[model samples]
Target: DIRDPARPKRLSAVADSNFSFWHSASFNNDGTKMLFTDEWGGGTQPRCRATDKPEWGADAIFTLTNDQMTFRGYYKLPAPQTSQENCVAHNGSLIPVPGRDIMAQGWYQGGVSVFEFTDPARPREIAYFDRGPIDATKMYVGGSWSAYWYNGYIYSSEIARGLDVFELLPGGLLSQNEIDAAKLVHFNELNVQDQQKLVWPASLVVARAFVDQLERSSGLTTDRISAVRQSLTAAEQASGMARRNALTQLATQLESEAGGSSDGAKVRMLASEVREIANVAR
Candidate 1:
């Protein structure tokens, strides 16, 4: 479904293959090429796993042309014989780096694998960070989900936890040295509680101060505030209780800030109030 305001067209398609179930798809930076996942391999059903027989062998990743969806090539994951259900690129994102040919793919239970797609037609796996071993038969799950290259690091969404950070380096296919070089920066280990304490209240206080300044400069009345409050209330309803409470608190602070006579003093007071709030919240 195209939910964007600029494009409101609905898209639908039919597949010929019974096993054809496109899980996720993404396009290149320039929208020239596209990549998609097909999870119809390794004895697994398209979306269900009823049979125990491992008839299907391997999940495949396919590259396609953006304009016509023309078949380009396929990257069949290595099927090592083990209790593990083999690596399947379930969901992934293309990182657009100027000099890099790497595409970060999320492998279910296989962890995050980076591929050197220099030869686009025949992409090769360069580095892989396995989430390590776990009880397979008991339903071993969890791996990289969404990944984005920002500030020279790959930020991955580890749905089971939070975010896992990694960095890429020069490497060739299946290079353990390259993979080891990439470190895992676990957010939880880095004083996450303290960080949250510092961030949440500060953000609310700053937002409140900004809204107050806008109101003062625009000479907005209670009627305008009521209208914006209504919109905010609707947004809160859509967002849920926690967000609504936070927003309402910010609005209340903004109202208080506007009551102050001096602009600089109001900002300073807001900052001080935020620090107090953070201390209490923490």
Candidate 2:
């Protein structure tokens, strides 16, 4: 705890045999989990080739409890890079997707990768952007040095190519609703290393995002999912007291359904969001 700047207390420290050099660290939105990157080759060696071990030069996920950290798992770029590309974990920042633990990280000469570690033990990549090595036949250190999610887009700082901006497209893994919901979060200033807590506004889009998650997890029945879609559509079309009434009704129904839902916590959250939206409806 850093409550006292004059005398900062050390919580805990950990190490892994697979990790060569600890480069940087970041926390999840709630700080319940932390991720550390391993700069195995110090950003100047081919550490992501087919023969390279996945555990080396990868990301380590850990869960934090009462300021103490415990190792959970590791995550590395799945695609193998050529020997000519000097690649290893670099820098990244959390993507505010609400209720999920996701990040956009950069790898030297390996490009940018967006992945989720909600499970911690089994982190998986959802999207990525990469370019071939600056020189196909020779190793030239040139790739994303840092990739951070700010506002609604990912801004990457390339070593030799300058800046690159990326937008998440709708796909099987990530829905447009989830992307839209993520865009709702805004930050005036961000320091990826400092790690900030993410707070999403209570809006219909957020509620819909939750519904989409429920569908993905099979947390809600198909009939209930369709009903929610129709109700949200109806509420959006209405105005004034009509919209408020519709949303209020839907929120109440959702709250009642939570008792039987497999993901009751998420259902309650969705209900709370809808209730807040109803309150703000003019």
List the RMSD of every prediction in angstroms: 18.6, 1.4
Name the best candidate (by TM-score): 2
lDDT tens digits, residues 1-282, model 2?
689999998889898899899888888887799899999989999999999999999999999998789999999999999999989998998888767898999997899999999999999999999888999988787899999999999999998999999999988778888899999988899876667667888777888888898998888999989999999999999999999999999999999999999999889988999999999998
lDDT of 1 by residue, 243-262 (tens): 55555465465556555534
Cα misplacement distance, residue 103 of candidate 2 (Å): 0.6
lDDT of every model, 2 decimals = 0.46, 0.91
**How far is 239's C-alpha from truth in model 1 (Å)?**
54
Q: If scored against the real structure, what TM-score would every candidate get?
A: 0.45, 0.95
Candidate 1, clashing residue pairs? 42-56, 42-57, 43-56
Deviation in Å, model 1, residue 75 alpha carbon? 1.9
Question: In terms of TM-score, how similar is model 1 to the real structure?
Answer: 0.45
